[model samples]
Target: MMANPNYASLKELARAKRAQYGVTTEALNLIVVRKIYSDEGIRIDNWEFPRTIRAAYMSDDADPSVAINKTLPREPRLFSLVHELKHHYVDRPKIEQGQIKCGDYNENQTIEIGAEVFAAEFIYPETEFLERLQLLNIEPGQCSPEDVVRLKRECRACVSYQFLRKRLVRLGFAMPHAFDKIQFQKLEEQLYGPPIYKQKWFQRRRGRAQAK
Candidate 1:
């Protein structure tokens, strides 16, 4: 996979943003993004959208805006909002005149990669996140999913395990094969519990089905 071209700069930006919010520890809250939106004259709105689409951006040049799908869970909503904000702050030159829609920006493999990159780096600053990983004391190619989950909890960040695993490899703390998402997920369940997002979504679907 091609690396994010803007990785270094985005990491710095995320760190600065985190510091600006007085985020000494714990998760970098979505409210920090909202503060940027306020400063940049951007507006936020919630709208219903298809399951595949998580967020959208409309750049008026003077006052840009973002819309997050109302149905998304808390983690996805925060990440999606950051992704759209990336479009607003970094990729404004690339965005088309009026609007652009993002369907799970991470999976959109073309022009939107920069936004996804920004969100990942912003959510997990490289140096601080790596320091957290170091405390795990796990060797290369030996990391289990439970370790990543614990680190996520420690960081108080809502990022996915897959992202953490990739960061591990990216930073050379772990080898490429060390982070298997599927195996990690299984170990995660055994250690922690079933994924909350899937559990909630499944319950909601079942309720809707019963209602119908």
Candidate 2:
């Protein structure tokens, strides 16, 4: 596949690869990425990358590897890993030949964007995302930041708010950057309270006691 491949083509390729790997939508929703890497025999290295570089793919005939930024939150790390998988599949030859670099966003814009498209589709198909929005009664051009936060909480897909925002913009559910200024994370915490892990110790203890 050439650089700047169309979105449809990239989506098809991603779904095909998912099938080949026996990765179901449920698995993707849960972010079972490391298992995929292990199954593919791709080595994973969690290293500290510069802020601008989220991950890199290194292709080798015997052992392909991906280095991800260790500091990235769970969702972005999962996205980056899948992004490198695109390079491993379609851009390996170019990467190995030094014609393309996987992590450099400044160069190889076409391939980088293509990888992003592939990653997004692989992580959560557009059709499924649309269906989810419909199930939640979220309409095009009328989605609110709070609706997005609820979507994140209710949807099984492990995606960042930025991911949801971009999808909304692409699907005409919202204008570009409409949610950029909104701190979805903070809002989520405000609305839903902190995630279970961050809840107060007494709250956790109470929950555990209630569970028994």
Among these predictions, the greatest TM-score belongs to 2
Q: Worst lDDT window (10 residues) for model 1?
A: 97-106
* Candidate 2 lDDT by residue in tens digits, 143-196: 999999988888788788999999898888987879879999899999989887
Question: TM-scores of all models?
Answer: 0.71, 0.87
TM-score of 1: 0.71
Instruction: Write model 1 residue lDDT over 85-192, tens digit each, in one string.
Output: 777777665554423333334445653766666777777666667677678775655665566767766766777666677776766656777665357657767777
Model 1 regions lying over 4 Å from their true place: 1-5, 24-27, 96-111, 169-189, 193-212
**How accurate locally, in lDDT, is each candidate?**
0.69, 0.84
Question: Highest lDDT, which number?
Answer: 2
